[model samples]
Target: MHPLSLRSARLRLVAVAAAVLATLAAGLTGAAGAQAAQGCEVDYHVQHQWPGGFTANVTVHNLGDPIDGWDVEWDWPEAQRVAHGWNAAFTATGDRVNAEHLSYNKAIATGGSVSFGFNGTWAGVNRDPFAFRLNGRTCDGTVGEPTTTPTTPPPTGGESAMDQVAAMQPGWNVGNTLDALGGETAWGNPLITEELLAHVKSQGFNSIRLPVTWEEYMGPGPGYAVDPARMDRVEQVVDWALEQDLQVLLNVHHDSWMWLNELGTDHDAVLAKYEALWTQIADRFKDHPAELAFESVNEPQFTGAEGAAGDALTEELNLVFHEIVRGSGGGNDDRLLVLPTLVTNADQPRLDALKATIDGLDDPMVAATIHFYGFWPFSVNIAGFTSYDAEVEADLVGTFQRVHDTFVDAGVPVIMGEWAVLNYDHNRPGVHQSGELLKFFEAVGFHARDKGVTTMLWDAGQFLNRATLHWRDQHMYEYFASGVTTRSGTASFDSVYLPSTGAITAKSLTLHRNGLEFQGLWHGGTRLAEGADYTVSGDTLTFTAAALTRLAGNRAYGVNATVEARFSAGVPWRVKVVTADAPVLSSATGPSASFAIPTQFKGDTLATMEAKYADGTNAGTATWTSYQEFWSNFRPDYAAGTLVLTPEFLAAVTDGQPVTLTFHFYSGATASYTITESGGTVTGTA
Candidate 1:
């Protein structure tokens, strides 16, 4: 997901419906200005009593002076409608419904009133405002009850602030070098495959950040060749992403830095390249809407001491950023875009540094980027081997907050681009490595949510890393699911990669000898087990996903692939691990869990995770159960500060279901215990 500009906190975590009802039970409903004379008002009590529609009862009271008749109308957000209405006559146009001419010169005496109800199809949920107008004037309102809770993409929707408590979803980077359209023609990697993409999506990430190389994806250079086929293919993956309702962000990554660092290309060439790239991209995706955000650069690393030079670089890049936005000619004036400035070579969106580089731009959709990997060897080295530390975590949060606040004050939104610490060996040592990185990203993501800065997960490799990131601290998927919530969305995709690994029924899998992209659902979990006689060996594995027969969503993932070991086991020892083409999946399970190098992670990059082992018996729910409830907790209350599980606590402890909460006081202890849940909590005997 890209950064978004915010207004204030950008988001307010809404309570669940049950909680709302509970609050109401506690007498918590009050109009912000409810009793102010009950002024000239008309109240509408709306209800959705059936499956697909709503019925609203509008009660108009002549609270002020006697009125001959009144007009009532509504404007719905999702182009909703009115099928049946009563009392007064009704007319509908598009999403507007108007009611006029009361029941036969219906004139309400001082406090007298008239009521009318209407029925209409909702088709969707989450209706807000529910406000109306009386006699062509806005009617003061109240939220009687809403059918659905609005889902807000938080900290900041865009160009605003965030709440800092929400965690980030597991995210992936669709690096240009890999599956990006025209990447192959641009003299970079082309090993990206459908198997790879599915592998990525399967890792529990609902967001994918595509870092487009402006120079490579578009424009003309002495030796440059852009292919329309590849570009279309790129769009196709993005379309697949949209199919998943994944938060997708596209950016001008690598190129900005490549140009400045290489010092070979002049501003004219760079601008021309940028303009051409945006023209093609924006035009292609002009109608794609909010999910796709365009970022100006990767990290514009400049030194403050070198004043003029840095300023020129900053100014040039800013101009190009706007130039691209303008030339794209998509009227993308509303699409979200991100921009970053040089801070530390390692971290980009630093507040103070960006303050210096904030170039004036008329386009209102751009944001800022910040990338902090602690400090290369320092953060990932033996000396600093910490995925997160209290002080360090607090510092990162403070920094992000400062940047968020500063940018929001200046009207620019910010994003954390390359924030994960290195997933390297010299630093992180075992199954806990990715867990540590997850802790860090989760903490940072918490801040991102609060600060309203959308973040890019960074580089293709790291993205794959977080996927197979060991299972212990597996909050990435939670983050992923939370970032994107699509209950009734569709899944339409195009790809060419390995056939299904879960089933071998002729129809379940397909093979394209020379394929690069593909698509399908992550319908289940489970490793495939091929025929006997196949051995897990050194270097590579060649297993045929040939014998698999079903793809139920909850099965363990086992493919019949030749599970090759990426590490040298001095002697064969038993441990459970996942063996697949994915490098980040190499890990150990059981008594001692160990994640291998470059294979596990190199720098600070969160990726998918897989546990590996000499023997596979130790892999199962043992690990999954550990994280089933990592957060969320409940308890009983007492008169004293410590919870003593008084009757109030037990009676009022809504566990969402019937559960007898048992309370106990340990003799001479400072606190009491109250346990009540599906598994029930443990309490000390008094």
Candidate 2:
């Protein structure tokens, strides 16, 4: 429905996965030998280690020239036993372990590397393997590194990974351009510019995700090198984003060859190219700031018929991707890496596969992501007026809630990576449905916020016109923005029925006072102008014949708010604000008379003060706590007015002077008042 050819892609993926399974089942390992002219090297990284067990990732770089197949042999001084491995077949003889390339990963391009990992056990020492032989002869160059530690930490100021993800909520995705079928401009969307990225930042989005397809520009193996000009283009875009101070996610996308399920294709050659592509990518961006995140794949689906087999293979690929990025060194070691489930679906079974894959792995910088689109009815089946109702609301909330309970609540941060309601149904371009569609958009935004998941709206020349640089649907943007910021609540709607063709008059419309504010009025997605379309006499509205026509058919012209509420006739509504229930300062001592003001009331203005001194003038100064200290240090003294304990005042009450102090607060009206402690505790008054 969203035009990605879902059925065709899924079918192809399944077919490929099935074929790969068959090949592996046949235990096909290519010719193995060590060669002097092969010019091979290895990057051996110890991912994690314990007293008795260790996990290691080995990448064999074929630096010499293109070869059909190769073998890697390593000797362990410790009595280490290879428990299991992926991407290569492993066999042991005493202290030597030989890993032969699998049927799908045999070929090694000139500069490409074939990587695999194994879970091994050691009695006392888990030493790094120093001697590595490729084919039969010793590797020509020195092994790059034996540990996975980075030279520097991520640029998150010590914030937890989930905290970083949470801060990126309300992000925007630059979809359909970079991730287009052909190239950045192939999807008919204009080439993205720095101005466009800046505009997105100005609209309150703090992050941008750029999905690029690179296979089209990459050369055939030995190295499978990406075209330098193409890479330069990608870097330029990333630079624009970094200039805007926005977090960026660069990912592989839309490469039909690497889609995982292409049956009958050379699986090994395909994987070799995939690995080579990432090798060049990781090395190029290894020096970038931690703000740049790398997502392994857009949506990895297994190639086989069985879902379980697909899940397992998908997990292995994900792990390999993680290892490559981390092993590339530099800032990449601590950079954020996002992993996607099969087909990018958040169904329970897919999530189980993800959990199983990540069960034992220990990487705090990694996060899991999934896409959200109501698969059948809402995502594709478009209808007007009735589509955005309770059922749709439940669906949005339920999907997010399930993901939260499974991944978020369990400590892993989850991202609602790509989500959007279609702007227009292809066949019905003239139809008006923004009113109900806005409702659905708001539901998704608020639901994601409540579930502690970050949502990146997929804006692909949909609501926002790329050429015109204007919002095509103003109401939709408004609703989506409100949902991201507003506290959880429902909108207050007032309905007015009109005849088919006649003037209409209605009495006053009132709304609930529960943090709900009147936003606007709409009928069948068409907004009714305030003065031209209808005249409001106080709370009463008188509509013209044209307005009646536009609002007829029981379509319901209604007033709306960020949150839902009940309409009334003449009742006044007050927006809910945070206020202290009790006194912030009960008592204080020393040279100055000090009192406390709650953090929530920091924005409240100080109206007036009444002071009656025991003797001399009562004068003092007031200061506000710093913004950073307010949240960080928990020193909640913002409006705590301090009175100077002058010698005269102290003399008047020699033993313990008691000076009366009263504080008044005001906005346009006298909002509230509080009494400060004179010489003893005085409760606040509001």
Candidate 3:
């Protein structure tokens, strides 16, 4: 039996329903001389209702007079309780509820309205409240005819593919789950749940790219029948996402490299299997809402094919998928279908090849897909490229521009199916500096929006923790979420380094205000005074010496305080005040396999390390670059006050040859040490 098959019988039965109820409570009719009485109306819509919970949207109309602020007051006729509300500040006293206007939606002009939504729960009965008041004016209790939610399937030929993919902007990938090699949980992610989908929707993502691997759960070649249980599991997840009103991008994941890559050698057999697999998938999801889309493959590539041949092979597979899905009956006829370039690369040739395919297909419901992970060295923290610098930014912008020109400019929509720094997949801190990582995501979201491309973050239990279901780093997630629609002010770095033992001096940082106005500096809830605490000269923010002294209380090591540089829009930039001094190293001798230098870091954090031989050639691992790979060749264990040299780095060194190592710290301090490898032994001197 398949691993995913375990939950086939336990699939939750979701009840889908929608209702729009309106009530007009007329205010008291006043005398002719009296000021016009205030009157209002309210529209409560049940957008989605399940068994225990439902999501609703309320609109408040001020019919009488213009008001600076408004609040909607209502009582739960049943036992329904608000669980989560948005677009309003909600307060509940017993069964009575007040939905007050937020800062952005406070004003309600005469004849204008404001809307808010919330998810609520009920034990047995869920009834709509008939009586409502807006700013103390009664909205009469004359209930309009109740209308059911629109259950019409998405048009098979009316809506264009561009519109379909556009609705899925800022998507997320459910990576390493169904796409895991052996089984769903083989990659350490838990089973998919409706609660997780709800959480994702609440995080502001509009769609989910679900990558499924079918090879492991299928029978022998001729039939290539996918296990019914696996199909049921996939449908269950897809239905859950659809029920949450989220677009679903379903694709043949991992299969691209698993057996599907042999198309060149075993063309007939591979094509047959591919056809069979997609046929089954299409049949299973033929009638699903148009919110569900099908992608040809994940990073399609051919094993023995190269260049144009590989491109041709991918094109063939995509065409086949498009034909099969479109030919199938029901909603798939006009469902948005996505195709990928060779290896899903955004290079000119690959994009051109995919564009040619889309052009020849003569179908308006097709989208091209590509993947981005920024520059490789910076992405994986190798070759001394640690920051999200000019080179990395250029790579990002250049890729998006090419894809835009290739597909988007020509009226073909593109989907960035997968993106994120590769090192982030490890979920390890310090692989990429915190500021650089945030900057990378910020740029990714900005450029994706700028280029009019849809991007789906590739997460495999990294960005969002699977067990806790919470963002691993809330601030980083904020940058990603905010970057989708607005620009945020960032800085050259996220920290201000001050010497622990030296006199305090004013420190300045360059701000990358991406077209937003700078507000002021803030520490927690209190805003710092501009002239005394800090000063802004152009893009540089200078923290006065007095402010630094006060912030660095006792001049302790590591981070002392954190402050936010608020901006006019988007997420605010965070700056850490850190106090550190030069690190010290102590020499020691040990086996070449396990050698560590005892180090007193004092108050500094290591950035990168450079190793070179006496003759000026690169030493140890990664000889191509004098700056060795971080964590791969050396690691700083600040907790243990030691820096360990991995066995691979030592083994690559010439026996009896001394290697000079320069360790760079984040606080502008460097320490030099010499290590000699002899036979199976190693000795170091500082």
The digit string of per-residue lDDT tens for model 3 on 1-686 reads 00111111111112221111222221222233344445566777776543344567787777666777767777787857775455665667767788777556788887888877776665456678745666654464322221221122212336677877876877889989999988889999999898898788766677899999999999997999999999999999998887666789999999898899999999999999999999999999999878899999999878879789999999999999999999998998889999999999988999999998999999988899999998988987778897889999999999999999998999899999999988665435567788888888888878888889999999989889877889988777767666666667789999999988768999999989888778888887678999899999999899999999999999888999999887765677889999888899998999978799999998788888899999999997788888887777888887888999999999998999999999988778999999999989999999
Give the better candidate number (1 or 3) by lDDT: 3
Tens digit of lDDT per residue, candidate 2, span 1-686? 00111110000123454345334423433332332234556677766543334457787777665768766776778777775444555667777788876555778877888877765666555666756766653553522111111122113256577977875667788888877877788887899997787667645566788888887788977788999999998999988887665678888877633654542245676677768888888999999977788888787754553467667666766787888999999988888888888777888888888876666568888788888865334443322122455677677777888889888888888877888754353223322233345556656766786788988888777767778767776535544544554422232222332322234444233332224333334443345577766554544444454544443434222221111121221111112111112222334433323334332333332323334435534422211210111111112233343322333323333233444544433222222333334454333333
RMSD, each candidate, Å? 24.9, 28.7, 11.9
lDDT of 1 at 12: 15
TM-score of each: 0.42, 0.52, 0.80
Q: Which segments of candidate 3 are over 4 A away from where they belong?
A: 1-157, 425-427
Model 2 CA deviation exceeding 4 Å by range = 1-156, 256-259, 263-266, 304-306, 382-386, 422-432, 487-497, 502-686
Best candidate according to lDDT: 3
How displaced is residue 601 in candidate 2, in Å? 55
**lDDT value, candidate 2, whole model:** 0.57
> Between 1 and 2, whose lDDT is larger?
2
